[model samples]
Target: MKYTNPVVKGFYPDPSVCSANGKYYMVCSSFQYFPGVPLFESPDLVNWTQIGYVLTRENQVMLDKINSSGGVFAPTIRYNGGRFYMVTTNDTTRQNFYVYTDDIYGEWSDPVYVDQGGIDPSLFFEDGKTYFMSNGLDDEGRSGVIQCEINIETGEKLSKSICIWQGSGGRYLESPHMYKINGSYYLMAAEGGTEYGHMITYARADSVWGEFVGYAGNPVLTNRNKAPYLIQGIGHGDLIRDKNGDWHILCLGFRQIHMWMPYHNLGREVFLIPVKFSADGWFTAGRDGTAEYEYEIKGDFEQKEKKLYTFKNTSWKIDWCHLRRPDFDNYEFYDDSIVLHGSGITLDDADSPAFIALRQRDFEFELSVRLSVDGGEAGVTCYMCEDEHYDIALRKSPEGTEAVLKLNIGGIKHIENTVELSSDSAVLIVRGDNFRYNFYAASQGSEIYLGSGNTKYLTSEVSGGFTGVMLGLYSIGRNSASFSDFSCNYK
Candidate 1:
């Protein structure tokens, strides 16, 4: 079985993967979010398992006031010798750092700061030497790709940097990767500002540093034509070869409507494509710039269903994460349900008190939650940004058993409907197309439609964020709430 685009859906971008010890480990940028840098493990390149995160402690960074796109940027994962290394840029601090671990599942070393004033640091080890490449603005105020050697032990630059390729087309370029294949060094990077003209380009050189030649087929892979949009704006990719010498490219792309431009979703999602090397030593993704049905792999291992979210056996999946750093004191898991205590701030606050959310993908989807509220305002919400959201809450009102459905469109709050419920537990169902939302509520075996409209209010256009949409359960005020049977289905 072959999966074409979006092997992992919804806001999974800037993928970097490295194979080691008969297994593959991958990581991606989780900007402005907590439990930073999702780590995925895979036996075969097609199937993946979410292992854990790189940043699990508060000491990692101060994210209290981190804005939508002001946290972590692009991250590159590489295996050097016996240690697995991850280098990332903290946009807030404008610093690049490196973290490594001997065992993939073991504790990773604290970030060793590299004083490189650039983003998207990729490490390449060749012939007992390590080289670091990044995208930075040069002396002419022209941002170009650069490469330099670094001391592996201490994250320090050992040589003066050299500019290889200053982007093609008149747009900003970033996300650079250096790989040595058959004695020739190849540099792959993204260009065209990651929007409509976003593309992946390559340049080749005889030496690690020097005159690199950009490919005549500059954008080796892109969706610049009309017709089937299986993948759009595909770039920021990393390439790897299996044991049998078959190559694969893991990149990020987005699915968007015509009104949303090309790459205007929350962020990029993961896409896999087969790769072929030309007789001229150049690599191109897929066949003729399109994805393939199936690719070749060397391994002969039996396929298995990878578990994503069973707390005991598998703690968390790469798909499961919060929008920002979560306050552990606000929530806990018990009796197969996640109980959230009310926080002082409402969902409107940039730093909302308690929210456990997952990325929203697909046009038609359903999210159901069985919630029990005791006091103040507490319930489940489908949020797009800080200002735009829709919630079905069980609140304490003058009426007996008060239930309210509220919509915050562009910072303006509108109560769509309110019903009085006599039951303790209520099942809230939120269904939506890409633009509109329908809210439903059920209690005591009775169901009612709460609200239905073009809730475009809950979109990136109305709300301001670097992400698309998120569905999570939240509680606020002075009391607490319990949420069970939390399920999400996407069609």
Candidate 2:
């Protein structure tokens, strides 16, 4: 069967996968977003469904006042002894921890902090013992992929961390994962800073501990220089062998909005690439060591896509996510409407505001919402971060309620356009494409077209963040709003 590259879409980056109980479970980095570590389960590698989040409770992870792309780094999920373990880094606090759960659909345990200091933590269990590795300085102050033994029960260091292979001369050596394949320990990692130059590299040794030999064709997978291609930044992969004994790498990659534009606002997403091992035990990924837009894979199931999303069809817990630690009192959800109580918090603040959003899954889409504001401002926003966004909202003017289009880029906050509304209720629309997002407003008469915002300004290349665009409903100041008829349809 043929399937698309990003089996899992949107801002879910740095994918790590492990199989258990005849199913494949994958985890991704959530950054500063609340409910960190998005988790998914797949019967076939080509089709993925979000099961839940690893950090569902507020205490499981910290996002209080966390900046964009600062809270959670890469997360690795592994299943062992009928239990699932998720290890990740809280970059803002410089802490590495792991949480475990026996039930895949149940809550996870509190974090058990590891003494080791590094990001992109991974756990490899073998022979009733566990090994920990991350990209940071070892006990000897040598920096690279550091390895150590840890007590899985307590997360205590059982051995001093030692510097493993420093990678095949690529910058930002990270995402260290170990696998025992055919009696040889294979150490796989990513390099090139998780950007356009990102790539996957590997080494092999007789034992877990090094004197490992790098693959002659190091950087076994990369799309760095593959210009004019929609896919780029392919790296931070976790290898999983399926029931058919075929190897595949679930990695992170981004889709540029336009060919030769070099701008991506949909964030790093999960891509499944085929991996083939030579007789000598070294493996090559994708086609010619580069990920492609589509692949013909061995799967019995047909790939299906969900193009339309509405409040009634999407789950509040599964699909919608907040910016950070949100105040529960500010949100109320019903059958088809959401009531947001603003608490004088604005989007410009790093702290959580009255906002709930779904990741912008594709470039060509239309988002429409009907909202009525009692006070302050209520609207739909194309949010990239605190410093970058575009809003079309209903606010109370001195004369009456008005529909306003505000464009926020860095320090420049401009009210691009405003239309006087006869009432407090209005329908706001945002039609987005590869290059720009067009805004519109309507009450009784025809929809009034507002100004447009360049999508490039909200891209990671310009905004300097790790996240993508989020289509969200937001409220600012002390007010309340009823948002209904929310629908986002992708073309």
Candidate 3:
């Protein structure tokens, strides 16, 4: 089937998918945030439901002050011999760990340290023998691949490691997955870094251990362009076959505006493309060197209505993740909305701001918040980075119900307007373009302006983090507030 851009959205990076029990299960790298390794299940690959998280207990891994992209790297999920396995690299210790489960949704086993040095570890088993592979920087300052045999029972390495691919281009290589087909072992890997230079490549070996030959078409897929491109940094992929025996490629893609560095907050979006193998055994992505249509899977196709979020739920949908570990004590769920307690810091504070935001993917989207604030300062806002933020806030002023629109663009604050609310409840509407922010309020009619200040500083280029912009409700000062009717729509 032809899948669209961003089959899954919002910061779900380094996706690894496996099929089991007539269903497709996916796990992605959840750096820093606890309850790590999001697990998703789908009857059809197109529509997915978040079932549970893999790391729920303290024994899973020791995570302390893990920064963005600092906790868990790429994770590979595979079901083998009546058990499911998840292998990942922890940057904190630069070591590999493995977790298994009889049931994917049930409690997962505690992480057994593999002592493997490198990022992106994948496991493959054949005929009762298990093999482990990983990729990372080598001794010579180049990215290289390593492999070893692992004892399934004890989760220990049984053989000395061997280096496989030295990588091509100036960029480093990572995220390697090994497969055996037609009596030849193939090692597929992502190279050219994770940014615009990303590319997927493969090599073949007569033996599982060495003498691997690079594919003639070194980079099976890449987005090397001097101008605009459909999908930027298209690599870090996994290949899977459907029940019908057709090959499909699932990889990550990034979308960016002309001047703005593509903020990959939609994270590494899941995209499915068709693949073909030549008689000599090399493979290529896309049918005719082009992306397939959205909704076209290479099997008996079925259409189902996409699920929408409802006001009633214990937590937001699985697609939502926080910039940092969420402080549950500061928020609570009421009838149909979320009540947020104000923090001591303001929105401009670097370390402490009570904001919950998501990625801004599409050019046109609408975010609505039903808010009532008392005491210090609080409201809803769209945050790109520390310096670049736009907020519609309600703070306690000498005048009653002071509602203000403020934008911190490049460390400068521009107050667009301030009005006194007749009642406690008010609505804030934020509309975004490809590269600009448009602000409006329900209390005022027809007066939407290009956020009335310099916003060049809000770009990700200035903010140092492996994240994109997030949009959510936030509170500041000592007072508290409640936000309801929180809804978002994309066009």
Best-fitting candidate, scored by lDDT? 2
Best by TM-score: 2
Ranking by TM-score: 2, 1, 3
lDDT of 3 by residue, 1-491 (tens): 44565677655667788889888888887766566788988776777667877877757865654544567778999999889999998877787999999988699998887756888999988888998889864334445898888897777888867687776554677888988888999888888877777778888988887688888777887764523554676788888776667676777766654444454333356666677888878888774443433636655665443323335542553444444445666777665877777777555654445555544545456777767887777776777655667788777777677778887776687887887766665777777655565666665443333243222344444554444456667887777788887766676
Q: Is candidate 1 or candidate 2 better by lDDT?
A: 2
- Please, what are the lDDT tens digits per residue for candidate 1 over residues 1-491? 44545676666778999999998889988777777888888877777767888876657755666666667888999997899999999888788888889988867888887656678889989889988878995434546887778898898888767676775653667889988889898888888765546678888889877577888887887765624553566778898887678888888876664444332334467777888898978877876875443455455654444323322332333445665667778778664577788878788876746777776666577778788877878787777666777888888876656778998877788899999888766988888775567888899898889987564555444554545666767889887798877767666
lDDT of 1 at 71: 78
Residue 311 C-alpha lDDT in model 2: 91
* Colliding pairs, model 2: none
For candidate 3, the lDDT comes to 0.70
What TM-score, over all chains together, does every model reach? 0.91, 0.99, 0.86
Q: Write the per-residue lDDT of candidate 2 for residues 32-62, one digit (tens) a residue.
A: 8878888899988888988889999989888
Clashing pairs in 1: 266-468
- The local distance difference test score of model 1 is 0.74
